[model samples]
Target: MVEVAMSNCANARPTRCIGVRVLGVSKSIKGNPVLDTVSADFALGRVSGIRGHNGSGKTMLLRAIAGLISVDKGSIEVFGEEVGVDGSFPMGVGFMIEPLELWDEFTGLEMLTLLSSLRGKFCVDHLRSTLIRVGLDPNDTRKIKSFSLGMRQRLNLAQALMGNPRLLLLDEPTNALDEDGQETICRILRDERDRGTTIIVVSHDREQLDRIADVQYVMSDGRIREV
Candidate 1:
């Protein structure tokens, strides 16, 4: 039987240090700029919110920091180490992108199991705790093909939280969640920050960001300014 923790999991990071630092990063596609000359610093033990109107390059910026997109200019560093064009952010960083695609044929547990196996890391108990954290039912062996949007969103979050990521890059994490689900995610993020993980949440949910973020960034037309 899978053991689901009745409460939230403990924080993985217990020490304070700088987490993510971005410097003059820029990215463009098809000669059109999405993010231009962006720079920021995400400190340890804080939940930083990135907010912008539609088409403001908020998601693009997060993806750049996560090493998902190639920067046309500038650099990104996590814990003082440079993250190059290749999608590498050391071993401790984790990221969740938009569209949260998962293998429909695989059950949630199966998906996580496969991912963990890819890294030769076995932690069934950790996987179960993460599933529980996102309000997923570990015992439900149903494949992801049958999961609702909200269920898929939760599962995406669970996968990102696997292996106790030190720097979490989230894009619209609360998009498909209900009020309770949103609250739970906020709680988890706060708990992680308290434990010394730096978080960068990109979302349009102003109310939620206001409640959880220590500071907020407003991105518009590929430019960023602290709000």
Candidate 2:
């Protein structure tokens, strides 16, 4: 366990060794501001947790960082490369947003194979390993359509972590998991950190975040601050 002092600490690391940087980022959706001049440095090989109320711009920030959406102003950098510099999708990132979706017709392994194929990378061994890591059976042939809510969430996370992603952006990763499953996710995240991956996780579960996060931040009304 990371054992972070969640209620009152947000560790600020030096910029030189950072993994991701959000600089003066602002976004307005149909004239309503979503992100306003937000800036922060996410350290390399560390887990940072973000907590906020609904519609607080937490998801938007992750989208921008993932290059799924562009910010109207400012920029995001991953490992020193600008996120939208070439108008191309950001590379080396894995993320799970709200309202997780999965292919109900395919088995767990099949779904992972398809998702990885879309990225032009697939390894059956790796995919199977990922499924097992998330407490799922690689040998099970049950299509995802028949899986429980918790199972789907685990598969969702497995995809995000299957590859060698330099950065990970996860939203409510433990949303539908049980107590043991939640603990499993936390341990996996810490293991990822130890493997030198930078993680930015957004969750409302303060206790959960406290266990895995090295530092924490709080967001409100399109603004973010260390806590």
Best by lDDT: 2
lDDT for position 58 in model 1: 92
* Superposed model 2: Cα runs more than 4 Å off: 1-13
**In model 1, where is the ten-residue run with the lowest total lDDT?**
1-10
Please write out the lDDT profile of model 1 over residues 60-161, one tens digit for every residue.
887777777678899888777777635565567767878766999999999999988876575899899899988998989899999988899899999889
lDDT of each: 0.82, 0.87
Clashing pairs in 2: none
Cα-based lDDT at residue 57, candidate 1: 96
> Model 2 — which ten-residue stretch has the worst lDDT?
1-10
User: Going through the candidates in order, what is the number of backbone clashes in each?
Assistant: 0, 0
